[model samples]
Target: MLVVKHLSGEYEQRDPRTKAYATKVKDASLSFETFELSQIGRENNGRADALSRIASAETQSLTGSIYLTEAKMPSIEKRECLEIHQGTDWMTPLKNYLEKGILPMDRREALKIKYRASTYTIINGRMYRRSVSQPLLRCLNTEEQHQALEAVHEGICGEHLAGRSLAFKILRQGFFWPTLKADASEYAKKCVQCQLFATVPRQPPEEMTSVLSPISFAMWVVDIVGILPTSMKQAKYCIIAIDYMTKWVEARPLSAITEEAAKKLFLEHIIL
Candidate 1:
């Protein structure tokens, strides 16, 4: 069911391998004037299901190894990206003082460096910061900071958390840089996906006072969902009618909504 929906583009493909397959399928389908995907049960799919079951069970019936090649690395790692060359950064001064007992010439600056470097330690040539709440946080350079923030904010497990939450998550993940909070705020604000699906603040944005309904249907509330992306049936708005007492909800879709349409929906779906 899901495979058919993904092929038809009714549902989004999120898995890397499945998304790749979907793209290839759509591209190959472009050659045909008409194309359709249908769900064929295993019973009607001939020996294909049997072959898959055999393959999954690791029962080799034939030499399919003729078509196989041992991959040296994963497919995800095959891409080329610019290598980040590590260099002098905010960590340079502190690292220098911590590792080599080096300090600036200025008396006040040298004392400052001495105090600051005391909170850090090097293990296996990597710097880590002392933390009271959790384990040592691994100090990051410019490149490491970018990589950590990217992976945490938009990686597989990421939920596109807000600024402070994003920073807190990174801290929990045991990474830190001087500008962590500021960078997290900036990154979350600029995230295209976050903006697209962001929640629309409902009316009565402030706290609501509870009202005592005299009866089950005595008090009611009405809300309109959107003038949103039109659906295939061309519905652009959703009207919801709710009874305050029983909390029963009746919702209906609308294309061109008017007071009359709202009235009819409430009468038919709710009152009836």
Candidate 2:
């Protein structure tokens, strides 16, 4: 059981100076009111149920018209409300809330949808965001596309196209995809700037097995050069170990090849 007491008091009539001070003090009091409701557990189930029933009944009886005015009401049609709540026509209330400086969750969702719609592009039979200048440049075939894609591929693999879009936006003036797939592929493959930075030398396929000589260090065939200067481990000179009987030749580097290294190679190939 709870008891709440309400006490009332009246202020005495005051002098002008005193009245002004009192009015000022009253005005200075905090303008906002705040309340909090707390639920308490009861020992008895029956008493709790009765209290809950009473509370529910009181709540149902206290209902009244919300946002109703005595004077002329603003035009809010029932159909509009139904559309906002049920159907996908959500612009009006969102705009109203935004205009009133209120940011609702629904408004944020609508804003996301609008942003995505504005930034989206269709490429290779799939829809992607036009957040990148490259995709737009790909559409427009602008001179800046190569530079943008180079920067994108530098930091990101082709797998993370979405993440690279922001980088493209930072590089050049944003545009739409204008180039065909073949052109785009050629640009990616041939971009000199990207090749200088990110391209790796491809390893050549192994040659078929050939016959070897019998004796060790007998027919020492020395091939001066073969492969290009751009190849990885660019060997300019080669020392070949050939077997007289087997007629087999094993060629290796001569630039930095040491005696121990050659001996190790000979042991692996000949001694074993």
Candidate 3:
């Protein structure tokens, strides 16, 4: 039996304007001509003359010698071989085979994903592993690296750094805790950014007063304010309040400062 083996090489479609479709091969651009019996006398009792005669009779174009080979039947367990003819397109057959389930779809998908994932450019001449989350080339600076490290650390702690308000605070202050070396707990505690921005300030408990203030409904403290408006459309008047003991301040907006309106606004905000 005669058999042919396909070679592995880069293949590309030819341009219609520059190349003839009839002469162009699918998947490859190289020209290929079928040779005469290239193998003979390598099999048991194989005659070189007989093989050459057979080749001549089969193709009628004998341009090469006839070599012989042992008849090794293809194994049933072996995967189907893809015959990539020289100067002939193999993409159609390949696509057919893939669509018909001759080729494993899952394996092909996995291979495609692997190829896409591996297609990444190096940064700063340093070989870092490719990943979807990896920073782009232009953004690969010292500050970006610090941010990335911080993000990774935050992610490990089950938090998303980018979504957190404290992220801007931490980045603006340029804070980094030495978690990898020395005492991580102590380092985190001493981080100035973490203390001033990331962490909420802890207020000492207010001292308990022995006497209680008399209850006066709607008789609440209020603030009045006026300022010139900027370019943006915004009101100038504002009000703020503070608890007597807690000292926590709350600010609100006010349109007018009439005595009756002020009393009603104070009652609505403080009492209600």
Candidate 4:
């Protein structure tokens, strides 16, 4: 029933997000003789939610007297920014031309800078180039380009995309460099994992997944969804059964996870 694991000592709450709210609840609970917290689904809690909304919305419309208070400040502190030194790179000429009208002494180069600056704009000290599909593409300096390449190719959520695809993906994410595609290609070529997992043996049109054939509506998998908000009927969990081959799914809301509840759902929904 306890959603705040740290407050109940079930587990140490390391998440700053929930821990802050949970701490306030724990402090307030001292005023009560006995207090308990339970999670319920939105379907059952809609009545109370609607009441709160009415109390907060259009107070003038309601003849009944009501007073509301709003929090003036954010719950979390502002994120800290890291200080880094940024030296000039290929974009310097374009940025200078656009911001300050600075141009190279060479007449030929100055004309080129004017043409390039037409495609770029500075926003809050950051440069962005005009894009057709996207409104703006963020211009990255040398250091930032490296970070972007590493992040897109090898960072936590990275899929280790090949050279050309990796470059396009970074562009899609609104980042750009003078040699983005070339750099991405070189970075991918140097990546250890990319080298190890390089696509090979072009016999089949696509890489084969499994040799064994699977039958439709045969094997199934079951999973429990959560300790959700408690419903008026006291249900807070969802049990789901999915057919692997057919991709058919069935679900039932439950108050608690139990063998009998699972069996009941299986008998009623899946087996039948």
- For model 4 the local lDDT of residue 261 reads 99
lDDT string, candidate 2, 148-193, tens digits: 5555544454422232343444334443343434444565566555
Kindly list the per-residue Cα lDDT of model 1 for residues 1-272, writing each as its tens digit. Answer: 78899998889888988887777778889999999889988679887675555544543555665343446765434477899876689888888888888899999999988888888899999999997778999999888888887899889998889889999999999998879999999999999999999886778968899788999987889988999889999999999889989999888888977898789987887778
lDDT of 3 by residue, 1-272 (tens): 22211111223425443233323233243434542323334565456556656633655454467444544752223457999755422222233343342443588764654453343333454322333544332212344445554554353552333233433334333432212223233334555555566756467588666633354331334577676353243556667765545555666555655677566655776667
Clashing pairs in 4: 39-229, 39-230, 40-229, 40-230, 41-229
Q: How close is every model to the real structure, measured as TM-score?
A: 0.44, 0.18, 0.18, 0.43
Query: If ranked by lDDT, best first, what sequence of candidates would result?
Result: 1, 4, 2, 3
lDDT (Cα atoms) of all candidates against the true structure: 0.85, 0.47, 0.44, 0.85
Per-candidate Cα RMSD to the true structure, in Å, reads 20.6, 22.6, 24.8, 24.4
Residue pair clashes in candidate 1: none
Give one digit per residue, the lDDT tens place, for model 4 in 1-272. Answer: 35745677787777887787777778789999999876677789887787777745787786655556675665554557988876678988888888899999999999998888888899999999896668799999888999999998989999999899999999989898889989999999999997788886769888779533288667878899999999899999999888887778998999988999999987888779
Worst 10 residues of 1 by lDDT: 59-68
- The parts of candidate 3 lying over 4 Å away from their true place are 1-220, 228-234
Best by TM-score: 1
User: Candidate 1: misplaced stretches above 4 Å?
Assistant: 1-87, 204-272
Model 1 — TM-score against the truth? 0.44
- TM-score-wise, the better of 3 and 4 is 4
